[model samples]
Target: MTAGEDISVRRKKLRYRAWHRGTKEMDLILGPYADAHTEALDEAGLDRLEALVNEEDPPLLKWVMGQEEPPENIDRGFLAEVIADHSARLAR
Candidate 1:
C-alpha cells in the first residue's frame, strides 16, 4: 500500500484498538465500575449483581453493563441507577 493508505490503515487500527480496550467484554461481564467499588465480593456477588441488572430494563442493563445500547440511546439515567443500587447493596 502507498504511504497514505498505510497511515489510514494504522489510524483505523488504532481507533478499533482504543474502542475495544475501553469496552472489553470482560469489563461488561465482570461489571467494571461495580466491581471496583464493591467489597466483600464472593461466590454470590456475580449472581446477585446479574440478578439486579436483569431486573432493570434490559436495554438499560445492556448500556450500563456495556453490553449493548438501544437504537436511540443517550441518557445515562440507567447507568446512574445501576451504580447507585450496586454501591448501596455492596456497602453492607
Candidate 2:
C-alpha cells in the first residue's frame, strides 16, 4: 500500500478499537473522540493516542474523567486536549 493508504488503514483500525473498548464507558469516551480527531492527528499524536488506548480502562477512565492524574510519563498535554474537547462537545 502507499504510505497514505497505510496511515489511513492505521487510523481506521485505531478508530475501531476506540469504539469497541470492552467497557461501555470507555467506548463512549474514546469512540467519539477518535472519530472527531484521529484523522487530524500527526504521527506523534497518533502514537500518544495508541499508548493511551492500550492502557487499562480503570486508570485510563479515571484520568480522562479528571478523577485522577495520569503518570508523569504520559503526554498530559495531549490528554488534556482530549478532555477539553470532550468537555466542549458535552457543553454544546
Candidate 3:
C-alpha cells in the first residue's frame, strides 16, 4: 500500500481502539473525537494520541476534562487543538 493508504489504515485502527477502551466513560470521551479527527492527524499527532490512550483513563480524563492540567510535554499546540475541538463538541 502507498503511504497515504498506510496512514488511512492506521487511523482506522486507532479509531477502533479509541472506541473500544475498557471504560464506558473513556469510550464516550475518546470515541467520537477519534472518529472526527484521527484521520486529520499527522504522524506525530497520532503518536501523541496513542500515548494518551495508553495512559490510565482517570488521569487522561482529568486532563481532558480540565479537572487537572496536562503536563508541559503533553500540552503542545496540537493538544491545544484537541482540547478546543473536544470542548466545542461538548458545547454543541
Candidate 4:
C-alpha cells in the first residue's frame, strides 16, 4: 500500500464521520470504501494530489468538484478531485 492510501484511510474517520451517519461508528471509520481507496490509489496518484494541494490552485479544485463548467486545470487524479469528492461527501 502507498503512503497516500494509508493517510487517506487514517484520516477517513475524521474527514468523513457524517458520510456514514446511520452506520456503526467503527464500520464507517473502517469501511470497505476506505480499504478500496487505499488499494486503488497508487503512489503517483497521491503525488499528483499532493502537488495540486501544495500549489493551492483553486481552479483545479473547482474543476474537480464539477462545481464550475470547466477550467484549465482539468486532469485525471489531482488532489482537487480527491478533496472535492471528500467535500461533497462531507456536505451531504
Candidate 5:
C-alpha cells in the first residue's frame, strides 16, 4: 500500500491477494479467512496480515498448517488467532 492509502482500499487489496495466492491450498486457506476478518482489522493488524500474505508459499504453508513455526519476526499472536479461526471453521 502507498503512503496515506485508504484503509478500505488496503483491505480490498489484501483480500484480493489473500484469495488469489498462486496455489489452491493457500487460496482456500486465506480467502475465507480474509473474508471473515479483514474488515475488522486495525492498521497494525493489517500490517501483520500484509506481512503474512507477502511470505512465500512453502514456509507460509508450513506455518499455517502447524507443521512448522513462523520465524521470530512474524507475529505469532496474530497468526495464532488466524489458525484458531481456520480451525474453528474446519470444525463446523
Candidate 6:
C-alpha cells in the first residue's frame, strides 16, 4: 500500500479497536472520538492513541470519566484534547 493507504488502513484498524473494546461505555466514548480524530492524527499522534487504547479499560475509563488523572507516562498532548472533548461532551 502507498503511504496514504497505509495511514488509512491504520486509522481503520484503530477505529475498529476503539469500538470493540469489550465494554459498551468505552466503545461509546472512544468509537466516536476515534472516528472524529483518527483521520487528523500524524504518525506520532496515532502511535500515542494506539498505546492509549491498548491500556486496560479501568484506568482508561478513569481518565475519560474524570475519576482520576492519567499518569504522566500515559498523558500525551493529544490525549489532553480528547479528554477535554470528552469532558465538554459530558458537561452538555
**Which runs in model 5 stand beyond 4 Å of their true positions?**
1-5
RMSD per model, one decimal: 14.6, 1.0, 2.0, 9.2, 2.6, 1.7
Q: Write the per-residue lDDT of candidate 6 for residues 1-92, one digit (tens) a residue.
A: 89999999999999999999998888878887898889999998799889988988888888877788888888557667777766767888
lDDT of 6: 0.85
Candidate 1 vs candidate 6, TM-score winner: 6
**TM-score of predicted model 3?**
0.78
Which candidate number has the best lDDT? 5
Compared to the true structure, candidate 1 yields what TM-score? Answer: 0.25
Best-first order by TM-score: 2, 5, 6, 3, 4, 1
Q: What is the C-alpha lDDT profile of model 5 across 38-91, one tens digit per residue?
A: 999999989989988998888988998889989999889877887888889899
TM-scores for all candidates: the values are 0.25, 0.93, 0.78, 0.32, 0.89, 0.85
- Please give the lDDT score for candidate 3: 0.80
Model 5 scores what on Cα lDDT? 0.89
Candidate 6 segments whose C-alpha is farther than 4 A from its true place: none
Best by TM-score: 2
Deviation of model 3 at 16, angstroms: 0.7
The whole-model C-alpha lDDT of candidate 1 against the native structure comes to 0.45
- Full-model lDDT for every candidate: 0.45, 0.88, 0.80, 0.45, 0.89, 0.85
Across 7-89, the per-residue lDDT of candidate 1 in tens digits comes to: 45544443333233333542343354444433433434433444434333545446555677545434355345555655565
User: Candidate 2 lDDT, tens digit per residue, 1-92?
Assistant: 99889889989999999998899988888889999999998888889889888888889889998899899988898788878878888899
What residue runs in model 1 are displaced by over 4 Å at the alpha carbon? 22-92
Q: Write the per-residue lDDT of candidate 4 for residues 6-90, one digit (tens) a residue.
A: 7666455423532333435323322333444544546565444334333333444355446664445544444344555555566
- Residue 20, candidate 4: alpha-carbon lDDT: 39
Q: Compare candidates 4 and 6 on lDDT and give the better one.
A: 6
* Clashes by residue pair, model 5: none
